[model samples]
Target chain A: TQLLEQSPQFLSIQEGENLTVYCNSSSVFSSLQWYRQEPGEGPVLLVTVVTGGEVKKLKRLTFQFGDARKDSSLHITAAQPGDTGLYLCAGVGHSGGSNYKLTFGKGTLLTVNP
Target chain B: EPEVTQTPSHQVTQMGQEVILRCVPISNHLYFYWYRQILGQKVEFLVSFYNNEISEKSEIFDDQFSVERPDGSNFTLKIRSTKLEDSAMYFCASSDQGPYGYGYTFGSGTRLTVV
Candidate 1:
């Protein structure tokens, strides 16, 4: 199984501050996705990156996929209180038809204090 | 927007009892999945069903667990016998496309507590 390592398990920042969460892995993936989960709720899909070196933006949130397809990052500019939640990175690969599920990373808990 | 729906927001059952978690995937979705997360842990995939059959399953989904799409709209996960370690949030998700596609939607989840 492919393992995704998410860094900075917890982040507490004042509103309007910028933050970046990282998810790294040694195995390449065919696609990478980011999801935000609130307390007591299932994760909501934020974005998916398929191409290597691809970058996608959702308002103040910027997501990037590494050229090697082994790492991804989520950068929030001027974070708001509403952005406070658990951020997760998941990857999917079908190499040699051996794996076909979304392998998730241990999430990064971000708290944007108001 | 269309969404996946799960019932029994929370359930508490005795160990060794049979428990069933129900889900209603989006109307048009063709692929359905079940995932679980222990408190403060990463989400773990349990099984994925497509074309009325299981496409994939994790080792964690052993003989005690089973999944079925009884009707066109409902997907269910059954635990033949529950264990204390089975306590966790169970999420159901559906996708219009296969694993390679991106339009996956997840339900709010059902919290199962085995005592």
Candidate 2:
């Protein structure tokens, strides 16, 4: 089974602090996506990395994919209370025929306190 | 922005009872999927539907569970017999293309509590 391991399951930081979360996997995937989920709600897509060693930035959030497509990371700059949520990383892989499956990481719950 | 819609934000049922969760995917999406997340656990894939048939399903999707796109837009998940273990947050999702296409748009989800 393909598994995505995320580090620092829980994190709490003061306002304006910076944090980085990592996601690693032994299996290679065609694409990796980052999502943020609120309690009692489904995950909302944040970004998707399709190329190896690629980097994308969204406001204060920076996302990077490993050269081998086996790992990814999310770095938040000057995090605020609004950035607090469960951040999840999911790897997309072919699952026979035209079907593709997403294997998700356990997730990193971040709490930004002002 | 378009959103996927799910009915009954919360559902509570007795064990062994049947329950059908409903969803309405994006109007233009072609690929549909069902996923579940147990409390304190990661989200897991249950099944994928396309072209009026199931394209793929995980081992967790057994005979007790089924999915259908009865009309042109509504997607439904039916559980013949619910068990305590079935309690979880069920999410419905859709994508314009496949995962490689435009990624996925998920619903708010239905929290199922099996007693």
Candidate 3:
């Protein structure tokens, strides 16, 4: 079974403090995606990174795919209270016929206090 | 923006009872998926549907679990006999492309509580 290990399962920080969450795996992935989920809702896609060593930014958030394609990271800069939520990382392998068959990490629960 | 829609925001059923979770994928999406998140656990993939058939499913998808695209727009997941462990938030999702194509859009989810 492919497993994704996410670090810092719970984070509580003051507003404006930057934080980084890491997702690591032993198997290579064809692509990786980040999602943010709020209470009473399903996850919302944040970004998708297909290439190793690729970096993508969405306003205050930055996502990076590891050079080996086995890991990824999400960094929040000058975090605001609105940034607080559950962050998840899901990986898609190359061999799955569905292409979108995902293996997900446990996720990081972030809380930014104002 | 287009979104995946699910019905019965919450459900409660007795053990051994049958329950069907409904989802309406985006009109233009070609791939459909079902996932569940046990309280405090990671979101886990249950099955993937394409071309009106199941393309893949996880081990958790056992004999008690089945999926069908009953109509042109609706995808349904049926749990033949519910168990306490089946209680979780079931999410329906759809994607324009396969996993490699683009990220999927997920519905708010149905919270199933099996008594």
Candidate 4:
């Protein structure tokens, strides 16, 4: 089974609408990161939440890390067409030695139509 | 800000042929990694190279897959014999010492299509 799971495989909303995507896992993560990828481009870092219960905001996007460090959420307020892209959540595991490995979720394809 | 750069943005090769994908990681980064994403699938880690050798690798990185740092500035992933299933977007990433608070910076990616 895939180590990480992301819900709402797809999302579509009109401009100014709100939407939320989720990432869940049975194992705890040392840190979680949210990224956005445009078609034909590499994913771009959005936010990284390290501490449990941490909440971070970047413009209209808000990211939250679960208390158990096993889940995360990204909420977009007043979504804009510019927000259309593939959203992916990656968990950084703590196996050993700086633990640079990252396990990625299946991803959520989001479309914000104007 | 420094970024990872991968070459041969797009490569097309016939199945069973040998192919080499090249990447130039950030000058100051210590960790180097290669990842690939099949169409519509999640990005998956292939292998990681550090200190002139491999540190970790996923099961997908089979014997056919090999990595080498031929010089001070280049890291390359070579496929002894490519297969149709090998078609995917391959990305190279690098990180500074922190390797935590700061997320990995990935290259534009090389789109490999095997026929």
Each candidate: fraction of true contacts kept?
0.59, 0.61, 0.80, 0.50
Q: Model 2 over residues A11-104: C-alpha lDDT tens digits?
A: 9999999999999988787888999999999999999898899999999999999999889999999999999999999888833223366778
Task: Score every model by TM-score.
Answer: 0.96, 0.96, 0.96, 0.95
**Interface RMSD (Å), every candidate:** 1.6, 1.5, 1.2, 1.5
Candidate 1 interface RMSD after superposing interface residues: 1.6
Q: How many residue pairs clash in each candidate?
A: 0, 0, 2, 0
DockQ of each: 0.66, 0.68, 0.77, 0.64
The true-versus-predicted C-alpha distance at residue A24 of model 2, in Å, is: 0.4
Q: How much lDDT does candidate 3 score? A: 0.91
For candidate 3, give the docking quality class from DockQ: medium
Per-residue lDDT tens digits for candidate 4, residues A1-114, read 777899899998899999999999888888899999988888888998999999999999999999988899999999999999999998887443336767899899999999
User: Between candidates 1 and 2, which one is better according to DockQ?
Assistant: 2
Error of 3 at A92 (Å): 0.6
Candidate 3 Cα deviation (angstroms), residue A54 = 0.4
Instruction: Report the lDDT tens digits of candidate 3 across residue range B3-58.
Output: 89999999999999999999999999999999999998889999998888888899
Model 4 segments more than 4 A misplaced: A94-98, B98-101
- Which residue pairs clash within candidate 1? none
Model 2 DockQ class:
medium
